[model samples]
Target: MTARRSMIRRAAAVAAAATAAVVLAACGGGNDSSAGHEGHGKSPSPSASAPASASASAKQGEHNAADVSFAKGMIPHHRQAVEMAELAETRAGSAEVKKLAAEIKKAQGPEIKTLSGWLTSWGEAVPTEEESGEHAGHSMSGMMTPEEMDKLQKSSGKAFDTAFLQMMVKHHEGAIEMAKTEQSNGAYRPARDMARAIITSQSAEIERMNKLFGKS
Candidate 1:
């Protein structure tokens, strides 16, 4: 009986050992499966995020030579328009002329800043006041000659009103042309949108100025 009991104890111990081995193997397999799932989850993170990063970079940097030209040309153009508008503040004879000049100044001043910012970001030169003055007499569409600008500056009352109206109408027409060119050729969305705005606003202002010509 003693030997049989001893044999039974040894058999039980062997069975327990086998059961423990089976349990350990199952736990290890579970751990391996969980680790595999974690690896799979992490694998796509970089690739998934890469496209979004690339797309954002592309959007921020997207621009062309036309966009550069548009900003560079329009900066000086807007500065001149603002200068003309400033002249109208004290020199204009008609309330309507003053109101129109104020509107022109309000609109073009921000646009000049925007254009200068773009040029600066693009590592291009912004036109200085002296540079703009130097090119004032150059044939850039409807740009007023030094003689014309001087005459407008010297005149006041009805003469100033008439000159401002006539010259502004012509200047607005030039701006429209430049804006149209940007709309046609620019790749930058903001610049193109600004160009469209310029075209619409200037066209309307041109019509208004034409109507005010003789009245002024």
Candidate 2:
């Protein structure tokens, strides 16, 4: 859970700049881009909401199945990850935890917007559901539960750090799985590249997390 949140938050942080001008609703007859929703401070979108829309869009072009699935599946997955990263920043006592949280938030923010835009342009449902679990649980790569998140948020100091690394490692692995699935099954150029990037980067992070967790 922690890892997933971190990833999404990171996505947002990166895309923060690009997301300012959103043209939602125009995607598939949805509500239209409200620009972070009137005063609520741009709530983080779960992965479930964006995929359906993305899938519809991906189908239109030379884009392959992997691209659609990657966007559809990953958008909700990234939402959970961003949430987790925020929890860490607020609850964690360690500087490392804070820094990591900042990184996650930075990276995920824009990805969320980018994927949403993709889905909108594609004219799909956005892969989101009314209930959060629509994601089919963390069974997919880079996903975590609210309960698991509670565990991470409750820890502190060394324990918090350890749990964070362990959880993030698993989270990154999940992302890798999703990415691999994209690479094998997806067809879009940019989407495929993103998948490969996730594979290359998270693999290293996974190793680092392991070493950190193993430390006595």
Candidate 3:
């Protein structure tokens, strides 16, 4: 009887050990599955987020007629400024004037391209100098007339420097006016942002020029 009871106890111990091992395996498998599901639920995939960001950027590019006008008008305006800046290389006497002209060219040259791109994207016609001639009588503010441009091209040394500064000061003021209109009326973010930058930077340049030329 003593031996039989000992054998029964040993069998019961073996059965309990097997049952515990089975329970532990099942619990570990369930925990792993839960962790996988939690990870999947926590964050979006990179591929999914990229398209959303792109769509938002596209929406920002969408523009209105005011935005279109701002771009169309600014293109030629910038082009003419670049033209004036080019003359500074040969005509300006002051190092400061030459530097300012170069800065204007650098800033506006790419801006002309950007404005043209915006017009094209909006399905509007980009204006050329010839095409822009229809508005010759009512030229955009601060534009140099043919006579004024001729005068600038004719002058050199101090005469060129003085004329360039005066013309550019007027030119920058016109840009600020246009920028204000864009700020108040335009819908495209990039165009409006450019307008604001033009206002700020050109305003500072205007002040610098005034101080340089002894003009209030």
The models' CA-based lDDT, in order, is: 0.90, 0.71, 0.87
Assess every candidate by TM-score: 0.75, 0.64, 0.70
Top TM-score model: 1
- The list of candidate 2 runs beyond 4 A from truth reads 1-61, 129-135
lDDT of 3 by residue, 105-181 (tens): 99999998888888887788899787444364167988778788899999999899889889989988988999999
Ranking by TM-score: 1, 3, 2
What tens-digit string does per-residue lDDT give for candidate 2 at 1-216? 999999999999868745643434255334333543544655657875788889888765566556777888777777766776787776666676667767777877688788777777767668664323534455566567767777887877777777777777777788889989888887777788878887887787677657656662
Better of 2 and 3 by TM-score: 3
For model 1, how does the per-residue alpha-carbon lDDT over 1-216 read when each residue is reduced to its tens digit? 999999999999999999999999999999999999898876566778998999998987588999998888888778888999999999999999999999999999999999999989889998888766757448466778888889999999999999999999988899899899999999999999999999999999999999999686
Predicted structure 1, TM vs. truth: 0.75
For model 1, the run of ten residues with the poorest summed lDDT: 131-140
**Candidate 1 global Cα RMSD:** 4.9
Query: Could you tell which candidate, 2 or 3, scores higher by lDDT?
Result: 3
Runs with alpha carbons beyond 4 Å of true place in candidate 1 = 1-53, 56-61
